[model samples]
Target: MWGREVHSHRVLITIRTKFMARDVHINSYLIVATCGGKAKREVSLEELRDHIHQYYIPLGRQFMVLFPEGGFLHKRREISQRFAEKNNLPKLEYVSLPRAGAMKVIMEEVGPHRDQAGTSKSDDRKDNNFNQNNVKILDTKSGDNIEWILDVTIAYPERVPLHLADVVCGFRPACTTHIHYRLYPSAEVPSDPEAMTTWLYDRFIEKDKMLEEFYRTGQFPPKGNTPLVTRPVRQDNVRYFILHLFFIASTFIQYKLWCAMWSCIW
Candidate 1:
């Protein structure tokens, strides 16, 4: 959706499931993690970083979404909570504890370096351009560094169908998917592994609270108090218009074909 809106490319970091890996089309733009494989060994952060550098960085992708929670299942959350307790980390309520190793690696690998003034050049550039046209533009492709890390939390108001068949068959109505996002300047992120880990954990704790508020009140917590700050949602109006035209043209052709066939049969 963002890719369409911004006219930029996207690459996904997904689990290396057999079904996904086998499809050549889907596998091309993905950095597939080997967590679900029979080996049960997870891919290292360095390896993931290398993969992104080699594939996605060159393509100039504007957004690379990473789910540090790993998995969304209740069992997975329980395991994560137990692990957090053992590690003396805060236990989250609505979200799983974020594994920060990958995030730290990503920040170090792609985050901007500080100059003599302890200020990031990337941040400076962004700030200089902020008031030019009332357009917020963060450059992520000037070189290797990513300017921002968008922390997004998604929630379903009602029960979400887990199965693909149910979704494809339209089992649910047009339900609203609540999304909250907060953009973290890459320069602001800690370089130290432990500090970065703590930082990631704190973010998840905030997400847990936001989810609690959402479920209780059916609305996200306000911007001032909430860590999940809202950004204006961008709609791809042009893309939708093109899709509408395509649908109408296809229906017209199908109708004409059906009428011709019926006439011949009569």
Candidate 2:
């Protein structure tokens, strides 16, 4: 099973079982499904996890296939590893298959039909650009932001659907609360890799043993996104780089002036 997406479905071929039943048991299973938003409809990663555990685990089936990109699947890897460590079950592994290889099989099995499929329209792109551009970030200790503005008219001449773009863009739901915010400028919109590191550190790591506790309980604490006040970090780096270059140019001018004065005296 790849996911609920009509196009990316799969059938289970075989069940491989490995049981280490100590005081605690570490059962495993593979899950597959499509990845998309809430309103579009279909099976969710959490639903798949529950389904696999309910149907297969008790029946002596372990090891589930999961879409590499699925959201809930992420917590599984972390939780399983923690369970294995605490109870000393065994190393847990999560495998990811290429989209074509695994996703194709799942879609073939379930045969789901998409309501609105295919490339997005120009108007859709324009709308996304407009929304992101006007998006306001509020409630931070520091005023730092990654500007996502665009010339909407030029960028999206006409309306278009954005299903494909959403997947490729790595957009995910985040905790948003309205609070006072300040603005910081950036040369380019900060990328996800950079942002995630900051988020993991400020939001996850900074918490007192949150990673360990979350792993043990299989629960994520409700931490407001206030901790992610590091947009200025990226912006500061960019600003510093620009300032350093300016300083170098100023130093060069001073050297030239000094040389000219010395040359005239000589």
Candidate 3:
């Protein structure tokens, strides 16, 4: 579980990802708000894809997203990064996009061969060879090779292609001998967490202002809704209840004053 503060606004978002039966779980919610509270709106997949393409993909980071088919998340980041490297396209961020709904997961390559049988091999490098960082010789009882893998879940909008999985797997051979640590979902791990957070914050809270500024500068209009923002707003019923209480109190006070006056006159 992780909490990230989006930039340009006062919204803190909590993120979590878990694995169950080969499926990854994602949960996210805002910790703080602005005004009128955030609504329970559907996360838009198209907008999410556009965000990754326009923002994250150019940064040269590895990311993944699940598909509607419900299979393994694809390794799209690795492929994109590899392509960028081959063609020398400055710096590109590698991210996955699903075909539908939101998703949350950060792909990281873990090292060290603990073996699926729960056998720890801290000294495997001095003892044996062949990829110890990625499960050596399969012990069979530790569940499938996929079970040993874990990921960090971040917020996402939908389904992505499966080919991205292969790309992520392609990067595992580079860790030092006998290293045990692996990458899990975390904003702290790749790029600038602060930058990402601030970008998201500005996207949500400053929609109208950003649009006007862009228009003034003659910039292209944003493709999706300008501000995908959320805020906590007070309810009208609560205000009405307060007024009703005041009215009742006023009536009671008037009745008491009348009783006092009648007693004095009597």
Better of 2 and 3 by lDDT: 2
Where is model 1 more than 4 Å wrong at Cα? 1-46, 114-143, 159-163, 225-266
Query: For every model shown, what is its TM-score relative to the native structure?
Result: 0.61, 0.17, 0.16
TM-score of 2: 0.17
What C-alpha lDDT values do all the predictions have?
0.55, 0.31, 0.30
- Indicate which candidate wins on TM-score: 1
Model 3 misplacement above 4 A: 1-192, 204-243, 246-266
Report per-prediction Cα RMSD to one decimal.
11.1, 26.5, 24.1
Q: Which digits, one per residue and each the tens of the lDDT, describe model 2 over residues 1-266?
A: 11111221122321111111111112353434344444321334334423432443223332334232233334444654675477554433421111122222222211121111222222254345332555422111121111211110001111112234453543733222111122222222123334422332222122223333434554433446745332211235588679888999999999999999999999
How does candidate 1 score on lDDT? 0.55
The TM-score obtained by model 1 is: 0.61
Give the best candidate by lDDT.
1
Q: Write the residue-wise lDDT of candidate 1 on 1-266 in tens digits.
A: 11323444332231211011110111344332223332332345435645555555445555555656554445456887899899897777677775555565556545564232242223444345332454422234433355666676777755242346654555755555667766666766677667777877787778778778888888778768646445555667699789889999999999999999999999
